[model samples]
Target chain A: MDERSLPDANLPPFEGGRSLLLGGAAAGAAGLLLTLIGGFIAPKAALYSYLIAFDYWLGLSLGALALVMAHNVAGARWNVVIRRLGETIAAAVPLFIVLFVPLLLGARYVWIWIDPPQELAKETLRLLQYKKPYLNFNFFLARAVIYFVVWSALALLLRAWSVRQDESGEALLTRRQRKLSAPGLVLLILTATFASFDWLMSLQPAWFSTIFGLYVFTGGFVGSLALLCLIVTGLRSGDSALGKIISADHQHNLGKLLLAFVCFWAYMAFSQYMLIWAGNLPDEVTWIVARSRGVWRPVGILILLGHFLVPFFLLLSRDLKRSRQGLAAVAAWMLVIHYIDLYWIVMPASSLDGLGLHWTHLTAFIGVGGASVAAAVFLLRGVRPLPVRDPYLEDSLRYVQP
Target chain B: MKRYVLGEFGEPEDCVEALRKLHEAGVQGLDAYSPYPLHGSDEALELPRSKVPLVALTGGVFGALGGYVMQAWMNGVDFAINVGNRPPHGFWTNIPITFESGVLLSVLSIFFSAIFYFFALPRPYHPVFESEQFRTASLDAFWVSIETEEEEPVADLEEKLRSTGARRVHTVVESA
Candidate 1:
């Protein structure tokens, strides 16, 4: 079949990106400043928690972009409607380059392996020193840079390929994407696992769980879904290039993705908790002890409620599944709970001795969240909302979730 | 002789209008194919109900059963490698992988079923390929094809097409 590539007329006006850029910048600055200040006023632990939250939030943003690239390269039909949202989320990858500065600076504060010579048993020091070859500050920065570089390259290639398809009508672009997906998925998993270990789990180096990376995967995957749904809801209201073909099936499929990830996250969280609890190991249990305890207990319970319960129920209804507004609300809640979920997982590492609340928590959240999101929005506003030349643009237009 | 008319479509509405006219003109058994699925084209052509979903569903059910039987046989009876206290059949632990396989199988089943059911893949060299409009169907072209047995010859098809909204009607011999 001669695939005459179709022209795209349905994108947001080029001029509109200006305001989104400005809003993103303003909001990002505000969020980052608030997060920083909140961290500063809090106890030392609160600072670590904020830093952790910042790391995860930024990480998922990058992860989302990576997911988009993969789906594009894979040329999978199911994800066509939401893939643009993922791509836009990915466009925020540069923000993570900047966002990691806090994580890098806080390596000493968060990671036991950082100050190798300080307070460690002979055996522990030996381990830290042995890891020094790969664990040193310089190497960490280099790896971070490499991840960003690889990520940005993939994102650009995927987005470029998609846009070119719009005008070129090369069906082979889809084949190219399919060829790239396996490698892309492998890269995504490796980077995500290492990042989880480095940014979240490494803070308390003594603790280890083989599945730690999968936990992050669960959250990142679900978070991406929530973000995708929310973005699509917003796009449905706006003049994104995809305005023509969005439908109930698309939203329903998004809902199903959201549901699957939600369930996956629960399963992972349960497996992690149950295994440690059953084994009753000191090293592994310390993380859970703080998490499952008194002041922190409510937070854990809240994570269960908001992260699992609310979204599950909200997404359960087929009616809600098909409606953009309903899914959008659920997506927004999921996003907020995602932050809270990260907070519960990471904050308790610091907050275990007692309930640690400080203004720094809010300030840092605002500082980082405000700045990162604003920057993401700013960057997103700079580009056309949808890839106009995507070879699959027409396919995406006709894509129903079913 | 069996009749067919083809037209170029600059806009989606043109295609829709063409479809509605053809349908009303009694162009039964007519089909339209485009580079992408057209919005409102379904109603315009008044095409017969699609069995693709049911075919896909049947494929999924078969896939799920295959997954279950495959995993069960592997872990339960085929090579039941016992590990300490866990049961010989580690069915619980096997569930995730099993689920993934089920999903994977279902997808493959749907894809292949879609191909065979629609006869889209393996590229059939149907007689309809003779029409230039038929060639454009893979690109920007929209067309309505009705065999002589389904409707009267050319004029009847053209009048019906022109009335509802055919941009043009051209005869096509099935591309042998």
Candidate 2:
């Protein structure tokens, strides 16, 4: 078929539905109200739950940023149809910075080593003292600000160049994006790693995993891919322009990527466990011991089954990957599992009873997740869903699996 | 003896077009050989989806169960031994090796099934090789073959093949 005959090439810009944005905003506001009520009722639980939600959503946004940059750096053509959606997702980085304010205010309730309680044992206090330079509040805030600035600038620059390409159709902009993506990716990895370390890992100042940063990154990457799949698949319904341009072959490719990252996440999770088990050091072993015994044990097993084995087996079939409903089902399952995975990571540290689930977990998740989706949808308004003028758009539209 | 009509093309697109035309003309027993897999050519030929993946899945399940059972029988029934005071049938600890064996057997099944079942390998001779043009099917050409009863008109089929874009067409006969 000739490329020009395809009606997708002349697709108009997406004018996002007002109801979708308004619905998202309403849900977000309701969640925020619940979070506030939960905070007043139980400040400590609310703070910890908020942190979990914060880290989960942040992982998704940054993960999308990294993927977008990766697509640019590799000059990949298969993703051009959905590339603008990724940019829109990445544009939520600034909104996350604003959300972080509550976490900053509530830090004292979550971080044990922040003020070093007067009742702390001699050994723990000594351990915390040794970690003082890195764990101080001032340094933590500064690092966070730096991470946001770097991520926001990169996302905005790439998005600006993409929008410019729509009007000018300058092939040079492609070269410029390709050039910027290389360093942009390096900066992303560095900032994301330290940010994960400072934000989540430091919750247990005594325990550490050398691979923790990569482990967190893999979860985020997998979650982001799942989110992208869901968003694209959702838009592909309802007679949208995206529905015509995107094909089963694109879904198959995305499904393959989602499978690869699921395996990658499993590998990272296993490697961390095996290393910690082999070393048997008290600090590292404590993290695993807490989760592997009692109520937390079932949660650990759930992660193993739901997060890895089920998705791995389901995605293995070529037919399933190519089926829109099947792929969407898997993507939705992955998104839920990703939230649980983050819950497994964050909640165990603070829960006195192993595998505790407070009502605030749900409220905070909705509050933060709803607000993030609203911001992303708002960014999508008045923009072309597909990178309409990208030199590779035709290639992406015509892509067929060999 | 059975007579077969074969058409050869320099490119996959021409071969696919030829296959589509022949199928529309009510041709039966159509098959294609190409230097590389061609998109939609399988549909053009109306071939069923291959069973190689099913074979692989069965093999993987068997291998996984075999691996787990071997460990369980060894530790719990056959010759029980205690290692680090873990349970006799600790499946959690047994997962890595079980997974390894499953993947190994699945891959091996795909490899061999694709060769033996799909490709029908190990035969030293076939009538397709009687035509020299068929040799290029593995190099840079596409070939389509149709089997028909001895009474079918050969010239008409050849003309259809030529009109549909085959570079060349031939008829071959061999004893059943």
Candidate 3:
């Protein structure tokens, strides 16, 4: 076979083309407007919804950063073609610093421990008092800033090195990336774990699970992979140049990773549930009881079937992973279910009454998710879709699944 | 009425090219053997995607349902013995076992389906082994074999294989 006949192996650099920039601006504007409207209609619900949306999008960006760092550390070849997408998504960590402001502003409404009701039992008050040092507004805000700063600095450093590698093609940069990623991954995991504890897990104040961070991390990683697949598939269809560079082999590898994370997320969720159920601690069980009862039970079931099983079965096939349309469908499904997973975690904490969807939920999701995606796409538009000058470019282009 | 032509190539790519050309030339019953799987060789052969995944899916579904039902029957109906004061048939408690069973059966199904259905395991011997050069197929050399009716001339086939970079071509007759 003639290798030269194949499309140019390098992706042309994209510089935020006029139409894409306009589209991103439009989406971001629409999302912001919807969120503002939601806040006006239902302040508390909007705050809660914003927290959920913030957690979801932030998880995605952080997860993408972790994946890219891990890939660099491992010197993984399969993800090289898709690595730029991960980097671009990770670059939005800085945007998250700004995005988290609404959550901080509304913290008093969303966090029960921030300001306890006077009628609360003495025991509950004491418990909130005990957690105060870690959960205080100032401390929480400071930690949020630290997490974002650490994450954004690392994201920027890694991305800058990658872009430099694109121009310089220096093999030494790969080594530097690998070396940096070693500590970068550790920092990411530590910060992400504590951040998860501080942000989402503290919503109920009394409820604590050691595995909660892992659960949240897994969900984020899974969502990031799904987003990557969706974007790559969309690019394949929309951009002929990129379509030629990224082949089915890359998609198949991505689908496999997505499936792996799906299983991981399920494992983490089940582990948390089972350990809590077995321990039967009052504080621990309260969280599960809140979600496992009333209308929340069905929602839990949906997460099981929709989030795990449905995608599990659909992605099991080799053909589906290899087919662009099939992989995209599964990616889309996973993305939706990932939001549901986050909603399941965040919403129940706010509305203990039962499973209910407020109009604010939709608005906040659209607002936050749309804007996050827009920002990431805008970042992506500024660079080549693939690292064209990487020493591994040919290796990535010729990658064949074993 | 049975005859075979075997060609050996120094490279996997050459073997794949020969197989593809032969396939495109309307040659019947073509197969390639290599020390390692060659990229795109499967596509050139036009082989159907394996059904092992479907088999595994069916097994997983059955296993999950079976595990769930067994637990539900034994605890909820058969004995009604409750542990931990919780409902015996609660899906939450059963999930761990259900997941284990599903994974176990899916893996087992893939193993059995691939070995028995796809590779046709347990065979003691095959005519492919009759050619001594065929052993190299599992080593460094790549080989392409074609079966044809005895009445058809294989000289043209040998010439075609040579054109595709086959180093050596040989004709073998098999007893019916």
Specify the highest-DockQ model's number.
3
Each candidate: fraction of true contacts kept? 0.00, 0.20, 0.20
* Error in Å for residue A52 of model 1: 2.9
Backbone clashes (count) for model 3: 0
Which candidate order results from sorting by TM-score in descending order?
Answer: 2, 3, 1
- For lDDT, candidate 2 versus 3, the one ahead is 2
- Judge candidate 3 against the unseen true structure and give its global Cα lDDT, from 0 to 1: 0.83
- Residue A192 of model 2, lDDT score: 86
* Tens-digit per-residue lDDT, A121-145, candidate 3: 8998999898888878888888888
Best by lDDT: 2
Pairs with steric clashes in candidate 3:
none
RMSD score of candidate 1 (Å): 8.2
Pairs that collide, model 2: none
**How far off is each candidate at the interface, as Cα RMSD in Å?**
9.1, 4.4, 3.3
lDDT, candidate 3, residue B67? 89
Candidate 2: tens digits of C-alpha lDDT, residues B31-93: 888878887787876878878779989999988988888888887899878766656676556
C-alpha lDDT of residue B97 in model 2: 75
Q: List where candidate 3 sits over 4 angstroms from the true fold.
A: A1-6, A26-30, A33-42, A351-363, B1-3, B69-82, B130-132, B148-156, B173-176
Docking class of 1: incorrect
